[model samples]
Target: MATASHPHEHRTDGLVVTSWFAPGRINLIGEHTDYNDGFVLPFALAVGCTATVSQAAQDWSVRSAQEPEPVVVRRSGLAGADAVPEWTRYVLGALWLLTDRGIDVPPLEVTVDSDVPTGAGLSSSAALVCSVVRAVGDHLGLDLDDDAVFALTRDVENDAVGAPTGGMDQLVSLRGEAGHVLLCDMRSHDTRPVPLDLAGHGLSVLVADTRAPHKHSDGEYGARRRGCEEAARILGVPALRDVSGEGLADALGRLDDDELRRYVRHVVTEDERVLAVARLLDEGRLPDIGQALTASHRSMRDDFRITVPEVDTAVDALLSAGALGARMTGGGFGGCVIGLLPEGDVEAAGDAVRRAFADAGFGEPSLFTASAEAGARRV
Candidate 1:
């Protein structure tokens, strides 16, 4: 994990400032299955967003390093969500939700900076919300539990930001552990911190950010989610999670609409894959999970139709370079691909993908190694 810059206290108009850090999450296996009440295995990334906040005297203002102008809102001006700049909406959403839920959120000045690459499907927005929420909780001395924080942050994205995201990103960002992947049960909202000692096993996860822009609010994502809901309705189940792997073939046979059928197949099978990967992790069979990762990429590409060419190319190149298994990670369309391979081959595998992209005339990709890291914390 990259080290956070040391937090130094300074008096600005006699107000002390503090900082908090939250991590972007990488889903190890599950894709587009979180909202289906299925299973997801995500780990916190080393890179994330940091929020520095201080109690302001009156008006609330937020400034991001990525944005030129700071967003200022009057304490009473919380009704118009669209009044603020597009990026500051996340910050405003957090404040508005917390205050609406009876958390006495004081007007504050927040300056943000992040290493989490936006639009890379790394859950950068969730990291920002989690970080800012931590700052708010810390400043108010509120001892909110994980579930409360998760619900609030998740709502910040879903209702406040108008993104139809599942709660996986907020949950993982809040509960992720060092050297562990969070096994999130979307049905019961339960979590298990499964150990993933990759370095000890002479393995590493290579992340290739295709840098293809994707947004949760985009129509394609919403359509996939709607398709899942419609599939569940047609299947007579509360969620796709209830559709067991053993019953998958029977379920698919019932759906006449080819698109909805594909959605059901992916969610049902993806849930099964998540459990399969978790069992392998428990058994210390890290290498065996590689095939599952590659299979997941195929499911997203063929069944869910979320993979773009850049992601497909990265996965193909990684496998050709001898990666044990590889697949596109995140919400798909355009995002990063994760490969499980021997740690010694990280360089060669990255180089191979670089060459593949150059040959395909695609933009150069960002390659990095990510280990399981801790979740949101005060710095």
Candidate 2:
């Protein structure tokens, strides 16, 4: 655990009519495996999106300090994804889906506040959508389970936002817990908690946001996802998750497309790394997962081609500064790198990354330690 936790405001304006929290998440090992029904290990961060809902006499309003304009969408206007401001779409989408499913939603003044860095591949969008869904669950007396909420928010991201992402973000954001990473099997949707004892072992999870804006909504993200799907189709497997190490070589040889081959290799190998991390934790070998972390970064850089120079530089600096292991997290291209470091070396590791970013001509990166915290909840 981080001794100096991120500065989080649990309360806004002294009090709120009704409030809910949905946290941003960090992927411990799993990368782009979710869509292929592969596995991922991720945990929730203490810093996340906080949504406050105040009852109004009759109109639905949505506002965010992070966004430029407030969106006022009535129930009838929910069908128009393009009608609202870009930032407000996540919340509006959630309401639209829930109401369509027969949840009686009343008018609300919704304000979203978050510490999670946008475009950092930290699942800020999921946090935003889940926060609204959670707040509505509390208000409307609706029985909202994690599975239902996952579907609701995912549809918003998929159809509404047209982002070709999997359920890893939404599932982890809603179901995470303190001192544990959720091991999610995408195929079965089977999830279990993996123990994270960073504080007890004199370690911390450091997230170094490069401030290089990236979004999965971009066309590149969708293109990579399609490439992975094509690889699976060529291999005669249902999905990439079904391709084992034994079959991976044969599968790769069958693909004439060089890009598809790399995509297959990354997802297959990355899924193994995720499972390996789980095993190491199970055996109480906390330090051993570092190599897996570095390996994941290498594959993302070489195979997935999602990582950018900014991310690579940050990871290299953290490792040189004594991080046990480090890699770029999120959807890649440009985002944040997470490092597992000795508690005592946290500040120095951050300093090295800063110097590295400056030397590389990238903007100043944000460095902070995040502890695993309880998932989405009323607070």
Candidate 3:
């Protein structure tokens, strides 16, 4: 990931300040399995959100270069769900969530800025919330451990932003290492640190933003989430996580509805793919994991039906350009595609994708090379 300078960084120009960072994340193999209480393999990106806070004479206020009108929130109204300044609710809601967990919210002026691309499925929202939380924690002198950080940021996203994202984004954002992938079991909430050596294995991670608006607030994302839950209920299992190994066939046969079966199948199989990728990474066999990544894209496209035309086109172009493997990485519909390409071929791969998009009359995608980086912490 190419790092960009954000406004929140480096501010000693005649004002006292506190700055904290939260990095964006990319899932290498697993997709749409986290909400089903399954496995995910994700790594933090160098690109991330940063928050800068300084004392204000008035109540809590927030400003960002991305938006007009600084958001001001009164501490009294923070407890209400109908908080003011809707766009900045992520920050406001975080204050309330923290208070709910018995931490005191301090009044401060917060300016949140991010280099993480919005709506590209790189966990930008999570990064933003985590960055804000870190800034607030830093300002208030509240010691929020990693676990509290994960839960509070996730609650802000789900409750305040009304985004029905699973816990993977926040978990990875909180616990990421500079050179490791977090293998998190959503069902168990058990996390294992796995080493990542993409460049060492002659690979480069490419992220292509198709520039499609991707928001999980819509019914499309929630519908799939509910469908997966229903499928788990119908199968009489706690979740799809239980239907693995030799028992997978039995679980598939037990499902009566074809649509429900498809959802369950994707979860079960995708979870297995996460484990496969983790194992491959462990053995230093990065090239062999390409097939699993492609298979994940196919399952999301055919069975889960989340991949848009732009996503498919970009993935196809990357694969055709001799990428090791290509797939849509985020909550799918319209977002970005992550591909593992041979080192030194990213420019050609990017060219091929741009040309393919141009030929298809689609908007040009923003392509960037991604590298693993550290997670949220105060600067």
Task: Give per-model CA RMSD.
Answer: 3.7, 5.5, 4.4
Q: Write the per-residue lDDT of candidate 3 for residues 1-379, one digit (tens) a residue.
A: 1012334334566556778889999988788899888999999988888888776776778898788789776664346657576658877777777667666566768898888888888988888898888777666666667777677788898887888988898888888888889999998778888888887888898999999868878899999999888888887888778887678778879878888888888888999899999998899888898999999999999999999999999999999999989999989889889899998899999999999999999998999988878888777
Q: Residue-pair clashes per candidate, as listed?
A: 0, 2, 2
Which scores greater on TM-score, model 1 or model 3?
1
Candidate 2 stretches greater than 4 Å from native = 1-16
Per-model CA lDDT versus the true structure: 0.88, 0.85, 0.84
Better of 1 and 2 by TM-score: 1
Tens-place lDDT per residue, model 2, 326-346, is 998888899889999999999
* lDDT (Cα) of model 2: 0.85
Q: 91 in model 1: Cα distance from truth in Å? A: 0.7
